[model samples]
Target: MTARNNSFDEQAVLHELKQFLPALSPGKTFTYRNPLEGFQEQTFDDALRHASEMLGYRTTLSLEEYRSLYNSKRVKPGVLEKVLVEKKGAANTFEWQDKVLMKKFPAAAESPSKIGKLRANWQKQYKTDLDARVHPRLFRILGNYLDHGVSDWKFPVRGKGFLDSMREVESNSFVSAFNTPRARNLLLQASSSINDLLTVIVGDEMLFKQYLFDQQFAHRGWSGLVATLEIGREISPNGSNITLRELIVFELLLEIDVLDDRLGRHWEPLSYRLPAPPEDLFAPVPVGEKSEVLAIWQEAVEWSYYEAILAELRQDPQNTRNQTGTRVTETTFANAVDSLCIIGQPSLLRSVTAEHRAFRHGYDFSLDPNGEMLEEILEAVVPSLGVANLECFFARTGLAGMDDILTDQMIGLLGLADTARGDLQAPLPAGLTKDFEPMRLLCVVEQFPETVLEVIDRLAVQSTCVGRRSVGRRSIALWLLNEWVHLVVIDPVSRELRVLKNRKMITYKSAPRIVIEDAVH
Candidate 1:
């Protein structure tokens, strides 16, 4: 132990080994600490890469998870664009967006250390599981030895170091953990250092560190506890002395004993089966396409949420009312039907048409009782007209001046008496009425006169008929389109239809249908 074998400093190696162990100790109180504290000096990306390569940790979300967020609009287009511009600049925004959104990358393969691989051949080739035979007994012994207050009975020679206690127990006990005479002899000796145990098992000075890491990390929970206790971060209530070096020595001896019993004493050191020296665990991790794609997607997903927060922060406090007070209302079914009745107003008609297309493609409309009733009336009319295209049925025809016959028919449809006409009717707004036309009303009546008559005859018997009920202008317009039962009134003086909000009476006339047909044609 005085002279360094193969220039290996046991104290320095033990200190370095502590970096890879789990920092949190098992106890009543739970604490959080980074497991890769050894590589803390490196950048976070580099540290994660080292952990993934050397320790097999999944550091980020999978590509499929990010893609799901994109589909759900959680990863918004504007937010993703901002993220791309910040990372790759404006020129490369589209390229990065395509990679994050559409392009697929293969999963990165892990490059783990080759420390225990040679020993693993025994299990693969001979079908004998060394860990299965060794770990349970080893874990139980270590757990009992390290017990703070849980165990009923204490281990013998508890105050002595881990190796010394194990040696005393094996020497005195009839039922020994070591089945082989060689392992028993090695444990009994006072001068059995970690290097001496490694020499017996691995037979290669360069691989000693790797072999210890591989062995300890296999059961990191137990090894990490021993390492934590050795560092004095955790203390046992029963005063047990343990060193990571002593624990490694005992574990190597146990492995040797298991190998001898299972494969016999003639088996060679693990080094004899090695094809080549193992890779350095602390080497620079290679960046592949998968890592790059994952990095972009991760940033984009994060910024999708972050951009909204940043935008909110940047908004002026004085202008909060402008940002927050405005209510966005969706177009209702009533508004849509009313808009169709406008003639000569091409811009208004085009906008309403676009809304209809959007609604068909899953855009939601604000619905109420009135809108729903209007929709029901349209549903009844649309089929009788033999037109599946609502747009075609509601299409604008040219404006014509209101006449005496058309005026009387419009009054009859409103269920209005001649005297009451003046009560309900108001002069249409100056410029709008001058240009307004009831094109949707004209399209239904003129194009399908016989069909409109037939539908009115059928609806006259139904309870849903607008008999004596005061209905809005939009409802009157929809019924006019369905059965020509009501002519949506243009201002009698102005000769233009009032399209929205004005309430008028509804009366169904069963006789004198020909007069309505003659007026329409």
Candidate 2:
């Protein structure tokens, strides 16, 4: 019991291993498992019976601490007997050629939705849901990620890595199949979800080796999603292979180059718009047009604009004294260039790949090859986030040919943040709305951490979890983080980003599937 005789022995275990050495064959294995119950019931007899000689011959005791008496053995006397009875009963579930345990789509349930619902229902009906604990595929995936990082998660090509990740997901009893017509429709509508589909379409071996092998990114989950999308397009071979919908999405994507949310910057904007999308938004830009487009992270804009307002108010204190008539200077366009280039690449000249390589030594970029593509993306997304500083920044710097960036909300937030600094007589810029909602949430936490419990109580009704119908506070934090890390606005002295978004208070609950009937009233 004191880590001596009771301790399991390795030398004796090796000796006991000799007993099965002669019998191992094509199908025989020392690590025999009850193939159907998942990875839960794996075993070998001598492996257990043989004690570690390191224990010096003391009795090996195996006891249920809850029970009064003790036994000097690893397991109960009847566990193997009970297991054998079940195995004999399960003979019908397998065949010489097919095994449920080995199959990709096993008969765990009629559907994926049923997987989770059944567990919930079974727990209610039978008073116990033991399946919650054990699942073969999922555990392996989790173990692979936790210990070895994401690199080991690949499956379906070389080995069982993909199968393992899938299994782990299923074991949660939370995942549902693309079951039901509605669920299928949802997946189709989620064309923006390029990352999820990448996993399904790509060869498993490629993914495991490329993205997972390196832990360069903070959240492997997010990084994997971005990298997957970038890699998935090449796998398809065809002038006429993929569906019309996929082609359309891909075409649109090509017209406007992407600045992945992964860049970790805040896009500056003011307020939300009812969104009468611009004409060019629907009309795809010509394939070979040269344009200058800025891919600014959403929050970085907020930080940038907030600071600009600071220098303005500090220098002229009275111009914005009345919030209405103060217009931000075009200097922001130049400052925007300065701000963006600050975080850019200590120097873009250091790296110039085909993707980011500006055609003509970064001309007005208005006529450069990369410019035309980025123009469409920036124009399309900028107005919506309402970061006018970015819009103004873009056009002012000639990143785009047209479109002023100043929007009502971004200006208002900038004004408000400046006002807060002036009002609190606290020397920091102030920052609201659904767009700023996450920022506001973060601001509150930084100023007052203790109120987190109370804050979640309010967010429960207001926020939605990621991948859900409504956006939750946590998703906002993730979205905010993309910008927080980039828009490096320190206290300028203490060198700390005082504004931090606390996602801790945000809860992540799986989304509920619902059937809806759309009709014209």
Candidate 3:
């Protein structure tokens, strides 16, 4: 079916969109097909093998990680027993338990008993998995494609436009047999328009369909949003979903940033572009508002990280382990921050402290002459994420005082320019372990007054989903009034996020509940 638009081929674009649908749909909907549609007919083990063999996707647990989990009793005997019973009953009990599990967790034949060598082998084998197999250059670009909010530095590309940067990435990417002349031609042709892109990118439509079975698994969340956009659902103001066309514009802007960074050239912003100007694509970030818009997007991305980790903490409590080796049931900034890559905002850090203090002790809001008490409490509730964010913010602002806590991982990752790597004036805190510095910093935030836990409890009670469920991803719900837009789900639960299909006044207490499809473990 062709859209009303004359310039682009709608049917082809829709076909490409089908490949990009999210693998995991929110449980708000009824039973959905597994994302790995091609391998759906196969058993779990067979599917893992097929996926890896066909797509080079490392879909199964690494043998090394599996062995560690099995030895540590993290993969409990009961679970294994249940799986064995479900699969083979009592027929091949001994062989299944000993030989089968052993085969699954195969050790490198050359260094079966050598820990260091096995680790090295696993790292190399897994590093070359799936995404990398998609043509090493595409993999590197995808791996290092840092969003503006996620990293301070831009991609080191000398491209003036999206296609140009892609060309640069193609040139620098690891060359392999997969990147054939045909593939190169396809990439080049795809950039002409949405129609050409869809038709050309998926070369030999039938063959490409087999190889690129599920694009959603390629990048779950973002691709999921793209799928949602294709479905023509009503987007809440806070919904991160944007049109495919708009995404193209954003990609162009990102490439412009890369060029500007590398060549120190002032490229025109999207708004100034004539003939299909980007301003017509979406809400254009004005020249003056660019910084503020970037800041807000950065904030949203940060909160997404925070909320995501919090969800994991709530759901995967069994996995959370600290330096002292205790199970952490409650949210910890260190755990949350460590699980994610993006840095937090200084302002959010301060707000969390103030909110906690007010919630812990019944404090009158209007009576405080200044936010002095809030500041003191802020010092107490600043998590390791907050500290990292502060350090990053300080580095960008040319301020100092966090050099001692900077881990080797961070120093190597950030690769801060000398001018940005400001000096630390304060003495190193005694007893800070190199690996567990985040944990030590977390100790300070842990001491702050409690309230977020209670908030979690309230959300759990209010959640529409039945039985025990750990929260999953939460998103902002954008509601539009006559002409203005407002955020409805300021602190939304997973269920509320799902139910925000359209925009309207949301009464948190009286919202209609959708039937629970599956409990988020």
Off by over 4 Å in 1: 1-6, 28-32, 107-128, 148-154, 308-521
**TM-score (C-alpha, index-matched) for candidate 3:** 0.27
lDDT of 3 at 17: 48
lDDT of 2 by residue, 185-238 (tens): 333344453333322211122221111111111122222222222223212111
Taking all chains together, each candidate's TM-score versus the true structure is 0.55, 0.18, 0.27
**Residue 375 alpha-carbon offset, candidate 2, angstroms:** 33
Model 1 Cα shift for residue 27 (angstroms): 2.2
* Higher-ranked by TM-score: 1 or 2: 1
The runs of at least 3 residues in candidate 2 whose Cα sits more than 4 Å from the true structure, single-residue gaps closed, are 1-305, 311-473, 481-498, 501-521
- The local lDDT score (0 to 100) that residue 245 gets in candidate 1 is 83
Candidate 3 Cα errors over 4 Å, as ranges: 1-60, 75-79, 104-242, 245-521
Q: Which residue pairs come into collision in candidate 1?
A: 490-496
Question: Model 3: per-residue lDDT, tens digit, 61-180?
Answer: 334434443454333344444444433476864555564344432232442211122112212432323232332333233323422223343455532333455555556767421323
Q: What's the CA error at residue 250 for candidate 3, in Å?
A: 11
Candidate number with greatest lDDT: 1
